[model samples]
Target: MGNIPDHDSYIAAAPEAFRPVLNHLRDLLRGALPDAEEMVAYNMPGFRIRGKVVASYAAFSKQIGLYFLAPAISDHAGEIAETGLTASKTGVTFPPHKPVPDHLVKRLANASIKHVDD
Candidate 1:
């Protein structure tokens, strides 16, 4: 993403088709992790708490990926499956047209924060 400095720039640099989805995810994460520090890590916009990254989102050519701690992803596996999205041990990839549900995003963000705090 070319050394983007913040979420705004990262979203601005993303493909037009994915901008709204990225913005929406950013909002969801921000609200869910209000104490988190907003930063660009690994070239992606992410939320960090107590020196640990709790959540992050990125835009790609074909899909948007929402990343969280591996335990958070595993804990919510069933909810993610219900959304019909593909997920790895640490993230979920979904097309912009069918973004992950906002409630689920918030839940995952909180779970991720808890995982790190513990």
Candidate 2:
């Protein structure tokens, strides 16, 4: 708990207050980007490959923010409306009480990866 050794430790070290959502995001990203390297970038848990950042997840005071290097929410307008995500320029936010739907997360992440690859 002193210093987060890596992504897994960062997620593990998150406060009990934010564990569930953080864990869910961790699981989702790991499943989606199985070969991506996990690192702490800008002090957040980040996933990347070939020097391009794909996605990162963090917990705010009362919400979870999943950020992508490319703009992802625009590609997911329908899902955003359907799943109740409060989107930002490069990411979307979900209430800690409401876990983000798995399909939406994968879609956004795949879009982000494609954006980086392109």
Cα lDDT tens digits, model 1, 1-118, are 6999999999999999999999889888989999999999989999999999989999988999999999999999999998899999999999899999999998899889878857
RMSD of 2: 2.0
- lDDT tens digits, residue span 41-118, model 2: 766888987888899988666677898865666788777878777887788887777877888888888888878766
For candidate 2, what is the lDDT? Answer: 0.79
Best-performing candidate as measured by TM-score:
1
Per-model TM-score, in order, reads 0.97, 0.87
The whole-model C-alpha lDDT of candidate 1 against the native structure comes to: 0.92
Provide the overall lDDT of each model, using Cα atoms, as 2-decimal numbers: 0.92, 0.79
Candidate 1 weakest ten by summed lDDT: 109-118
Error of 2 at 52 (Å): 0.9
